[model samples]
Target: MAEPFSIKNKLTLMTEPAAAGHRMILSGISLRTGGTSRAPFASLNLGLHVGDDRENVVANRRKAAEEIGFSLERWVCAQQVHGTNIARVTGECAGAGATSPDTAVKNVDGLFTTEPDLLLALCFADCVPVYFYSKQPAAVGLMHCGWRGTVRLGAVRMVETMCRTLDLVPEDIYAVIGPAIAGADYEVDQTVIDEVSKLGRGIRNGAVTPHGDEHYLLDLQALNRAVLIRAGVPQEQIQVTGYKTSVFPELFYSYRKDHGRTGRMMGFIGMKNKGEGTS
Candidate 1:
């Protein structure tokens, strides 16, 4: 397969740009670099709830937005409760959680829209960020899925909402599974395995592998791909990035690797509504 994502630079892995200019949609995940925060949650930490200084986090966000070509004023963030709940927002919902967590979309793990210039963003350390796009309707979606959100059918709901609410056709959609903790670095016990087993034999067989006594390695990206495939998206249309958070400490912040005190990387998807940026 080809590279799952591209970037204007090494700091942000962006989507394919418009052939000549910034007239098209933009989507990408921010690498854990180019920011102002201190260690542990060191530099480029975009999440507000991770105990980083508020000013530093906001400054980091401003830097990210400038680099990503999306204005913070038009960005909508989620509180991300790790549930399957998702919200579809428009331009008016911009900057909801750009600087603070309290104003973000409540309890939603996902966000999507057909609206232009309205960036939907969610933060991650080791959790999965799922991207969905339909060119026909010009729609894009983003979701935050960890173990809890995965088992709760977060991706499935995003697909359903697109088809039902946005009138998109499943076969016409493309999905990109972003970086997260790889199976080799993520070990789980019986309870987690049992929860995954409920997903069905096909996914369980490929996603869960025995690592040791009563322990299994869980592949979150693979699991989300399977879920999207089962939800009617074509398997071939989905692209999974090999970039693993736990494996690449230099490019990403790994929650498991850092032992619960790490920064976050933001995954964003949106179109530019004819603005002063994105050249």
Candidate 2:
């Protein structure tokens, strides 16, 4: 989606000023971001909770972090529940909190933090992985959006969460809709089609596609983009990957592709001011 990460793609990795303090690395076994495991998990698997060997996942994360100049320990992960819950991360929440003994600060699908050097990660298979960064507020956020979360206005919720809590305007924020199940492959029943169809005309027209009789294919990315626009983000300010996760099995792990037995990939973001650590 983002210009098909080429052999020269590595040069464009750190081009975004918003990503200067942190690296947004997407894996490519060939030309796409595929997990490095094999068979059910293939290579590049980044999820530890999916029955993947914890040690292997850890090793994969280590390489990803090292490629970007961050400690594998500095990247943080969350326990997601497909809800619209958004957690505000602080300096105290650094590193993967999955195995943390503390339970007081658990649960959430989206996370935001202004802390420099505190990277944030969220695991995804087919769900739309959304990343938000504000050049104005110097804050970053990650969200996992599926059909359930999308219907709950998860992307809009993330935007509102940042705008209301961090004094950020929608225009000042830039968002990217990462690789996910495109409409052509995401067939849904009439009930679901109806539910999404009711979400105003943009979704009904721009994101929904017919699939023979009682089924329909939904474009979660376009729907999310529409939600962002309705929430006040300028069209140009938002970037959509539009990459179909299920299409490229080698580069990405798709629950649909593997019948729900696949490992997950981590989409993360972190930021610091220019004068702070060089991300």
Candidate 3:
């Protein structure tokens, strides 16, 4: 019920409210705002590997960067292998995956960077967008958490990596569990349920419920929240958005709802450079 993501311009951009004196721009862009891709991908499709036109994907990425007041060359991304691999990015890694998927940081689902003016991005449809920010160290990270990544404690890994790499404490880190398919809309097999249960009994209790034989409704957001808490992030410092991608097809691209033939929305976070303004 907590609407942590505030819609700024219909579906173009939704940002987290400024809190704890931290003003890093954390956004989950929608599928309706920009881009030149065709149907299924439609418009505003930032992902290049989703069968959308490569040229359109490039155009869309450039448009997104321009809208955020950064050049496409400053955007950094990953291949998102649905694993727990975390990549520590620096200014030297700028434009790694900006224009082409092959140039993306290989085999990583999470990206952490202290460098300013560089956007950390991950593509998602139903997978959760886990965001991390540390005020003292002035760093930001973006993570892609699908079912596989969630079971592997991707959020926990990201937080731990940030704390170790940035020399910050978990209590000072602010995390946001971004939009994804809600439990009511996400049904999983017994194997997934068992895997998630490995997190602990407490995490398995309300996080998943039996739907039918060998099926359960899984709450990935809740599971990720528990993971963050167990990883030492304070409950008060974490924000979970209520938007469900599958339930809101008009404003988001839903892999499940669209039968896996859909586009992807991007989760982006970065610290602005000196004298740069948020639009």
Q: Cα lDDT of all candidates, in order? A: 0.86, 0.70, 0.83
Please give the RMSD to the true structure for each candidate, in Å.
2.2, 3.9, 1.9
Q: Write the per-residue lDDT of candidate 3 for residues 56-136, one digit (tens) a residue.
A: 988888777766666788889899899999999998889988899999999999999877778888899999999888877
Off by over 4 Å in 1: 18-23, 273-279
Candidate 3 TM-score versus the reference: 0.94
Q: Per-residue CA lDDT of candidate 2, range 179-270, in tens? A: 88867888888987777867887667888888889878888888888888888989787887635788876566788878899877667677
lDDT of residue 180 for candidate 1: 93
The top-ranked prediction according to TM-score is: 1
Leading candidate by lDDT = 1
Instruction: State the lDDT of candidate 1 residue by residue for 1-279, as single tens digits.
Output: 777776577568886743113336678899888888999888889989989999999998888888887778888999888899888898789889998899998888899887777889999989999988887677888989999889888988899988888777788778889999998889999999999999999988989999889999999999999999999999988989988999989999999999999999999988765454562
TM-score for all models, in order of appearance: 0.95, 0.85, 0.94
